[model samples]
Target: MAEVKASMAGNVWKLMVSEGDSVDASQDVVILESMKMEIPIAAEVSGTVKELKVKEEDFVNEGDVIAVVE
Candidate 1:
């Protein structure tokens, strides 16, 4: 399983993929808003999304696990 982690502290602006969605490496799975900017959190590997750890508008810290893929 691959854990999708936050690169910086931010609020989850949007969830681009839901659980069970198929994704390719480097696909943007979530959007984060920080410092008045929108940042995309990308998948590092091709796989199906197993779980979503954060919901839209949720606050997340740097290194927080946002999702799990398998």
Candidate 2:
């Protein structure tokens, strides 16, 4: 399994993939808003998304697991 983690503290701006969705390596899974900028978090491995740990507008800290792919 691969964990998609938040790179910085921010509010989740959008979710690009849902649970059970297929994702490719380096595909953006979530977008975070911080400091008026949008930061995209990508999947590091190609697989199906097993879980979505955060939803849109949810706050997350750096290193928080945003999704699980496997």
Q: Model 2 — which ten-residue stretch has the worst lDDT?
A: 13-22
TM-score per candidate: 0.98, 0.99
Worst 10-residue lDDT window, candidate 1: 61-70
For this target, which candidate reaches the highest lDDT against the unseen true structure? 1
For candidate 2, write residues 1-70 as lDDT tens digits.
9899999999999999999999999999999999999999999999999999999999999999999999
Residue 5 lDDT in candidate 2: 95
Candidate 1 residue pairs in backbone clash? none
Q: Which regions of candidate 2 deviate over 4 angstroms?
A: none
Local distance difference test values of all predictions, in order? 0.98, 0.97
